[model samples]
Target: MIIKTPTSHTFVTGSSEGYTPLNAFDGALLAAGIGNTNLVKMSSIVPPGTREVPITELVLPPGALVPVAYAAMESDIPGSMICAAVAAAWPTDPAKPGLIMEYHAHGHREDAESVVRRMAEEGMRKRGWEVKTLKSMAIDHRVEKIGAAFAAVVLWDL
Candidate 1:
């Protein structure tokens, strides 16, 4: 089987409360505008020369398999906070692949985003690459009953 490398990436985030954990997850995905597609979890790597796209501009067909690096969390405790975040750090060298990081915890969206951004930077540093740009998205949900938070870096081909 031949795998085609993605040529672009986009960030998305959403949070919701529902009757069950799975329902909450589904609601969050719908809020994120990615409910219909199948999320195929992928390792954290952004190919060299990949472009950034706005979530509104990046379209996917219903039931399409989408590659994503993401973070998600679910909580059933009333009034408790749950957060998820994803970050991408592009290298200074155009030929070098970028790094992506995901983080999730019981916290604020800002905290989750901070951790993932730092994670991306550290990942790039570990690869001996200097970061030129960094982008991230995060979501936080307070559980009325069951709640979920989700964030993702979606990869797509041209």
Candidate 2:
């Protein structure tokens, strides 16, 4: 069997409040523009030569199977904050593969984004790869009476 790799990827973030935890999560996914697709969670590897595109550029079938690296956080406590972030670090050499990092916390978007950015940088450093570009997205949700969800993802078509 031959294995195929993704040709491109995009970063997206979303947050929402809902009547239930699951509903909140679903809302977050919809806000991220991926709720209609089936998600396949993958590890942190950005294939070499993969192009980065805007999320709006993606055109997939309603039930397409999407591959992603993601982070999510949920809270039901009123006034509580939740955050999710994802970062991708590419090497200076375009032919080299890159790294992706996901982070979630009970705090603000900046904090979560910072953590994941550092994580991605460290991942590249550990691999002795020179960093060229770092891209990240983060979402923060303030919970109300019911629940709230925050999510960030590096999404790609298979």
Candidate 3:
């Protein structure tokens, strides 16, 4: 297999409802503008020198394999809430790779968001790196029948 290091990254979050759990997940992906692409779930690591991009400036072709660190939650219980979130902490040292953290739970967006952000900070702390910049995104859904929430830090190249 070939390995490619991404050049840039972006954050995305989306919530959706559907008839089934998988459908709800798909809808959430679609709502996040990342549907139709293969999401290759990757571990939390932002390569050194990589920069952040606006979600609108990033695009993926259908059927392409995309690398991401993500959190996802799905629930079928009506009126239940689900939240997903992700955070990226860039190290103050440009030579060091940054860290990414993901979290999902049956809770409000604020709860999930806070957890993921702290996770990022803890990861950087473990590495003895100080965060130069921190970025995050989160989404929550209220289930009617089936619902899903998804958040991700997409790593990509031009």
Candidate 4:
């Protein structure tokens, strides 16, 4: 499910007509066994409604050994379950050459956002994804924000 973090709403209302690298990432993780075996898909829940938007709706196998982030409104951090949720929430768009998954994270204590960012960067590096270019993506964390939160994005070329 798409957890609308307190940080930004851009990812919430963004266009639905784009590729979904998030789906690719999910597939990769599952294949690598970084997630559970009974993971459910959530791409259909992007414009997450009230009750259906819950993280459990996008269930992945629990007890993952990986570092799972905490659940917070301001950030959709990359816990193993959240990653599964992201993979589930991911949708495929033909507009781009690849798929994309975008979300945010909260780091109230220590550098939570920074940690997630580093993990993503390192994970990508381990996967051998060279930085082709840096594009300015958009996110809308509502006003009156506190603590540390950051937008996270992933893309993959099919």
Candidate 5:
């Protein structure tokens, strides 16, 4: 018997404001173009030789169980800021699995993205892998009443 693995991945980011924290999170997920599906949170590893795609190119059945590594932030204080980011670091050797890093905080998009990027780099370095490519996405939200920011690296089987 053979075991199949995810063949492709994508990065997505989104932000939204709502009357409640849960609603804000839902809005963020919708904005990220993944609101309807069930998300299966996975650990931080990109399969060896996985291809990268845009989120718009992903066509999964409605309510399908999707695997993802994600970061999310929510704020209820009016005018407070939140940011979320996710990064992927692929190794120079395509046969080696890569790393995924997620970060969320009360900050700006740049800060959040930078942090996750560094995290990805550090993770690859620790594993003695030279990074071949780095990809990241981030979102920032300013809370009116309740707001959320979300970022993810979604994976799927071919």
Candidate 6:
């Protein structure tokens, strides 16, 4: 499912049998009516290829963190630092504050490592996270057919 500002687009390619008439709009209306959605619920589903993954599969436990990692954009393009932007709730002493969460995207752009470094520094020094760690190594996939692929990190913190 690809969700734009207001409309959500879903794509389905069934086996030779073809797909049934599934209406994403109707489903969205139902979801809205049921009061099951919030602002971030807009892009609630996984991207095209990651559908089979389980929701709890990538969760990082408290006191644990993922490292910096990279994926090949296809060998021609240079690699970039990537951040797994996440909304997190810091554990409060009494939970009195409830869930204090914030939205942040981390990582360095392919050509701008300095910018990434600065952002990382800011996040670590002032972003309220209890921990920060480089999660994964970089991989360059600069194949011609893939075009000039942007530097990106695929895995995410949910």
Cα lDDT of model 5 overall?
Answer: 0.90
C-alpha lDDT of candidate 4 relative to the true structure: 0.27
lDDT string for model 1 (1-158, tens) is 21889999989998888889999999999999889999999999999988998889888999989998889999999999999999999889999898999999999999988899999989988999889999988989988999999999989987
> Could you tell me every candidate's TM-score relative to the true structure?
0.96, 0.92, 0.96, 0.24, 0.95, 0.24
lDDT of 4 by residue, 30-148 (tens): 43333343322222112212122222233334642222222222322222121111111211332212122333432232243334344444444554554332222322232231211
Order of the predicted models by TM-score, top scorer first: 3, 1, 5, 2, 4, 6
Model 2 worst lDDT window (10 residues): 149-158
Collision count of model 3: 0
Mind giving the per-residue lDDT tens digits that candidate 3 earns over 1-158? 31789999989988889889999999999999898889999999989998788888997889889998899999989999999999999989998998999999999999998999999999999998898999888989999999999999989987
Clashing pairs in 1: none
Please estimate how well model 1 matches the true structure, expressed as its whole-model Cα lDDT.
Answer: 0.91
lDDT of 2 by residue, 112-150 (tens): 889999999999999999899998888888888555554
Which of the two, 4 or 6, has more lDDT? 4
Which residue runs does candidate 2 get wrong by more than 4 Å? 1-3
Candidate 6: residue 11 lDDT (0-100): 17
Local error of candidate 2 at residue 41 (angstroms): 0.6
Worst 10 residues of 4 by lDDT: 9-18
Flag regions of model 4 displaced more than 4 Å.
Answer: 1-110, 133-158
Q: Give the lDDT of residue 141 in candidate 6.
A: 22
Question: Candidate 3: how large is its RMSD?
Answer: 1.0
